[model samples]
Target: MNKLNVLFLTLSSMENINERGIYTDLVRELASRGIYIHVVFPRERRLGLPTELEIIDNIKLLKVKTGNITETRFIEKGISTLTIENQYLKAVKKYFGNINFDLIIYSTPPITFERVIQYLKKKHQSKTYLILKDIFPQNAVDIDILKNNSFIWKYFRNKEKHLYEVSDMIGCMTKGNVQYILNHNPYIDRNKVEVFPNSIEPIDRNNISIINNEIKEKFQIPAHLTLFIYGGNLGKPQGIDFLIRVAENFYKIENSYLLIVGSGTEYETIKNYIDSRHPKNVNLIKSLPKKEYDQLLRSADVGLIFLDKRFTIPNFPSRLTSYFEYSLPVLAATDKHTDLKNILIESNSGFWCESGDLDSFIHLAKSLADNNVLRKQMGLKGRDYLEDNYDIRKTANIIMKHL
Candidate 1:
């Protein structure tokens, strides 16, 4: 067997490898499976470190400087993502100039990696694969961030198309995403797209048990109230306005309570709602440490997920992994475009409601909250579904097969 060299391009921060994350786990899996892996990602000025190389175990990671794109406003994010290319290109050549990579794997968010991908592909004659985590300009259009065919729209849209064109194959996060690409962009060959769901290293639940009262007491969460928690990015992409509407609907319900955690661009928007409304049944915690957050999930009764109704592109959030990891049942409100709702229904692991349907969401959420036996049954199914489908080992095998 020939030993293979791989280059991973991503926008994820590698500052803390000890903390578990999606991309880190995937790369680690590949490394462990006897694949030679090299990762490149941005290092912010806030870390106060020069552009440098770090090696962990056998995997090589190069951290280069880039603008603060995440956790910022729209204009800043645009500039940061676009400007990251030059920095990434320089770093790629500085370190990897002599090496011949077998496969170049990358993810989207900053589709500005076109030049680097094209450069490396030509140099090494490498197989390029895009882990298409997002479909951008259309998402921007959905959220009113960009006007149709505007200068900025044309720029990013062209970049998106070019990235697709350059990739040897495109791995989508869902079946809906695959179809969205093929459906809208008739120019793309149907053979180029396939489902590549977000995967994680499944957590051990053998020693875990519901500490019903301990966490509830500590957090001042009521013992009798059925907790419905949303514990990921709280932002426009999540349809915060609709989330506020959902919370408002349940504010007066005695048995149901809502817990909103995580922070993002729209954190202040959520914070203000909580302060002004001061609803009895809703608690908005800004954010929590990952360990504490895991503890909270283990204690919670239900996990909640949301996506903006306006999205024409299917968006899958990885927070579903945390819910499945704890054997907690989920209730998702999503746009029709994503088939996570379908998967949840098919697995019998959770309930789903259309993003725009407050009445249906309220009905399902209340029905699930009222039935402990049903919730427990679904939670068990969720664990089975996650293990069978999304285990990182399986994900690694899938990518390796393509390689």
Candidate 2:
């Protein structure tokens, strides 16, 4: 039998297939099973790079040049998103047009990829899978970035529905996400949508030797304190205002420290707060390289997740996988709508509180800080849960079934 060929469409910028991430891990797993994967991703203007293609371990990487899609002004971001489909289509035609793809998979952020998916499905007679990572226009509306049911909202909503229509299968991050989509968009076939949570290649931290003291000293992280880390995006959807409030009152947790990493539009908000208040227990890092961030993750005691309280859509942040990889307990404070709380309770992996509740967050933080035994137990459970449920093999198998 001929080796199956697959095309993956994504906005996530990945330069290599061996990078330790959800997408990279999944692609590597599929490639190991003798699938030829073709990935089409962005080369944003900020990088000053032309569209390029590279082949690694039987997998093809097509980097298409597009406008600034991340961490830019609203107007540029909007225009970039609107034009991405055409840019991607042109690049795909010029390069991979001759290849008869067996399956095509795409993820969401900009729902404007309808035309691209529609064209590919017809051209190659390929099966299409939609990885519903972000529920866009509604999520924007929840954060007050876009007005509900406005002209812009209607335009994107139509595009979103069309994207769903073209997809042969839809995979959501969690069960709550699955339900939310079915409830809002009743037109979608329920059987087509299923729980395909964000997953990763789980690493056993036991085998990795982490020089804790060196990492701590290098980053000026307090050696004695119970370190709590909030990594990933520092954006509006993360509920920056509430995160700042948590940092302001973080001193209430005895012998505990908070470290905020990653960059986004709301980065300066936290930066300004830290500069003005100079909170002793809270340290803010604008960003860190992937290697340095993983080093920091290994040294940290607890992982933190925060989502805006206003979201009606269930938003599952992928940072949970990073925390679980290092056996770090998760402490998430999100809106009541997300099923993160249920996952924490079921896995016995960590604790959760409603996003805006300061007392609950501090209480949970202090308990985890004071009790090393409890933290260790939860951390082990988290690692176990991650290996069993969110493994890359499971995700790859799901996509393979479609083929």
Candidate 3:
């Protein structure tokens, strides 16, 4: 077989390439398999830094500096993303020059890459694959972020449709995701889209166990209670207000303890609530290193997944992989659209409840907290299911078939 060369366009900063992220793990796995890969990501903004190139784990990386993004306010973020196309185009011409890749793969967030994708596909005659992580304008509408019939909504709405039109193939995260795209976007050809669930590289879990009691002791995590962990970004999309409410409901439940890890826009909001209520059963942690975080995860009894009840988009958080990797049972409280509930039930791995229902979440949390044997059994099932289904190699092979 001829060697395949892939040029991936992602907005993930160069700073997070080594971290446990959706693209991070998959790109590492793909590079390890000896495929020729060139990745272009944003150069994290530092005061006098210039676009640079580096090689990491056998993959070539080009860090293209652009305007400040990611931690900035809304208007700045919009401007940065909207202008990213020019920056990326210049960097590609300067660094990659004339090196025709066999395939082009990109993900959606900015949705401003339509022009760049068009350029590469036409220039290299390459097959373009879009990892459609989430549906955009509609998702914004679902959360009341972008009002319909407005100028901003119209701009993004057109971009979203154009992006779908340009790609040779679109990889939706789930069957529900695929159905949603087809049903909502009648302009898209049904043949162009398929189910492409989120996947991660499988790890040997035999030697990995809950960390020694020292970690628990160091954090003052009570030994008598069932520890539930939620580690990842905490922001509006996660339903931060609802998360606060969920944490509040558990304050009086002595047997169930909640540990929330990481930070985001709503970090202060969550911290403020914790401060006000002084929930003795809840522990709040700032983000830690990937290794440290995994160790922390291993020490937990269950994983907590949350999604905003207002989301019409089938938002799937990659954090679920961390839970499965540690053989921890998951208790997911997400909006109704995602098909995760069925998958969880069929795998016999975990249970899911609607996001807005406190009673349902509390009931599930109490049941798991009350039964150690059931938690362990369900955790093992989740691990087995992860190995069989979410293995990165399987997902890579599926994408390769389209190439």
Candidate that scores best on TM-score: 2
Model 3 agreement with the true structure over 290-389: per-residue lDDT tens digits: 8788887888999999888898878888888779888999999999988888788988888899988889888888889888999999999999988888
lDDT, candidate 2, equals: 0.91
Off by over 4 Å in 1: 210-215
lDDT of 2 by residue, 332-381 (tens): 99999999889999999999999999999999999899999999899999
Candidate 1 vs candidate 2, lDDT winner:
2
RMSD of candidate 1 to the truth, in angstroms, is 1.7
Model 3: CA > 4 A from native? 14-19, 46-48
Model 2 RMSD in Å is 1.1
Q: Which ranking of candidates, highest lDDT first?
A: 2, 1, 3
Q: Model 3 — TM-score against the truth? A: 0.95
Candidate 3, residue 306: the lDDT equals 89
Report, for every candidate in turn, its global Cα lDDT versus the true structure: 0.86, 0.91, 0.84
**Whose lDDT is greatest here?**
2
Give the clash total for candidate 3.
0
